[model samples]
Target: MAQKDGSTGSRERVLAAAAAMLAEDATAKLSVRAVAARAGVSTGSLRFHFPNQRALQDAVLARIYGHLFPDEQIHDRSLPARDRLVNCLRQALAPTGTGQQARETWTKAYRTYIASAPTEDVRAAYRAMDQAGRRRIEYWLTVLADEGALPKEDQASRVRFLSAVLDGLSIERALPTDESILRSETETLYTAVDCVLGGA
Candidate 1:
């Protein structure tokens, strides 16, 4: 019993350490050695809990999503499905602030993942983040579909389209745009939602 409790505690600590590393630097490589060092645990212990880098990354992403989204708004049946989805997507974008902050965010992203060839670890980190985003969108769409508010077919295409719209809007946020950009972004979001839900 004591051994089991200790193992659970070690797992929690490792996950917390990994999450902290990601919070500090979004592109940080979550290698077993690094995470274990951060957690003050042995590499064997981390591997016992997480098995691999992908497993650790997925667990951390799931934890972050649970804290950020919480499913309350997504499952709120009072609001229209489109509204719930749009709000969720907006929540994802809220981190990329407007004006200067957004510009800095974009600059960092470009330097980290776009300007030059990324290492294997960097590529894996980016892919994990991207997959997590897609999974979150797919989960929201699935809930709406289950509620009979959205079509169940072509979910992959719908998620991809919405994600593309979001990527474009995020880039727009960083650009030297006018004040009406926010309003325009919201309108674009609504249109995207309508297109997906309406199956257009």
Candidate 2:
């Protein structure tokens, strides 16, 4: 079991290396040799964990999703319902805690995933991540309702409206903006979230 655990840890390290490489430089083509070197593992070892290059890519995509669109539940019942909702949506928007530079890198990586070049498998991985993001939003909403923080109203409508507002702010942030305006995005997001959740 110890032996298996070591190998498992190594495998995870290789995947993390690849994901970081993908996030650090989005334009660089991810080659087997490159990833192996970046991961500080022999090519044979990399292949031992991942049967093929495509398999490694798939693992990297999964790792990215784990950061970008997590399915894990966040239980912060200590906070007020409004605060919990704010924290939850803030997490959903940027699970990686990525700043502007890192966020741009991730954006580029995603654009490549949906590009015309990759095989269907690679593209499909990305599509699944989209579904996972939606499900995560619903999961948090359900938790809030169950906690009696949010009223047991139309959860679906709340998710949709909140998602739209968040996504819109996300898009707007992509554009060049002054620091004051960018800083306000957080307060604005909380205000919008509070209003939509009927807690304002």
Candidate 3:
């Protein structure tokens, strides 16, 4: 059913609601009908916005990416490579909230997404997002090379390796209940980086 005024805002509201639901429960068995019911919209309205699960998944990923990485200048040449890398990793891993409730909720949502056994289309969507993230890593690596911290020839491979490490750490430590643990692990990772770069 069209909104009385034909506002697209209603469609956006439904998408946002679906993203929240997906974030909260990974195995929620979602469908246009279910999401429509959850979003307080008619089934026809949900279908009008998203015709299939793949469409819904892509929309959800887009919303999540926007939330996770807002429009911001991510790299600064003025800072040392290590500092810039640390800043990027921290931003990527920063917890969204201070308390256990928020941490658990966000962690659960992230875990669900990571565990997704998506369809071919959903997998392609994930791959595109992964490539974007890897590009960010490569950008940092290029900056590091310009700063003489790493060799320029292997920058792409090096960034992929570093990104994998950071992704592992994000899954492990990003949801810490204690700020001390988060700080300690981050400092430990930075120390490892320092040792590696010290010889360069």
Per-residue lDDT of model 1, residues 1-200, tens digit only: 33745998898899999989877766577899999999999999999989987678667766776687676477788898889988988987888888889899989989888886888877977877776677678777777877888877778899899889988899899888657887999999999999998852
The per-prediction CA RMSD against the true structure, in angstroms, equals 7.0, 11.8, 12.3
Winner of 1 and 2 under TM-score: 1
**Candidate 2 residue lDDT tens string, 81-129:** 6777677777666643335754685577567774547887666665565
**Candidate that beats the other on lDDT, 1 or 3, i.e. the better one:** 1
TM-score of each: 0.66, 0.50, 0.49
Model 1: lowest-lDDT 10 consecutive positions: 57-66
By lDDT, who's the top model here?
1
Model 1 residue runs over 4 Å out of place are: 1-68
**Candidate 3 residue lDDT tens string, 68-168:** 65652334657776776777766655643434654674567565555666667566566655665665555555546556887656555665666676666
The lDDT for every candidate, in the order shown, is: 0.83, 0.67, 0.63
Q: How many clashes in candidate 2? A: 0
- Candidate 1 Cα deviation (angstroms), residue 67: 6.5
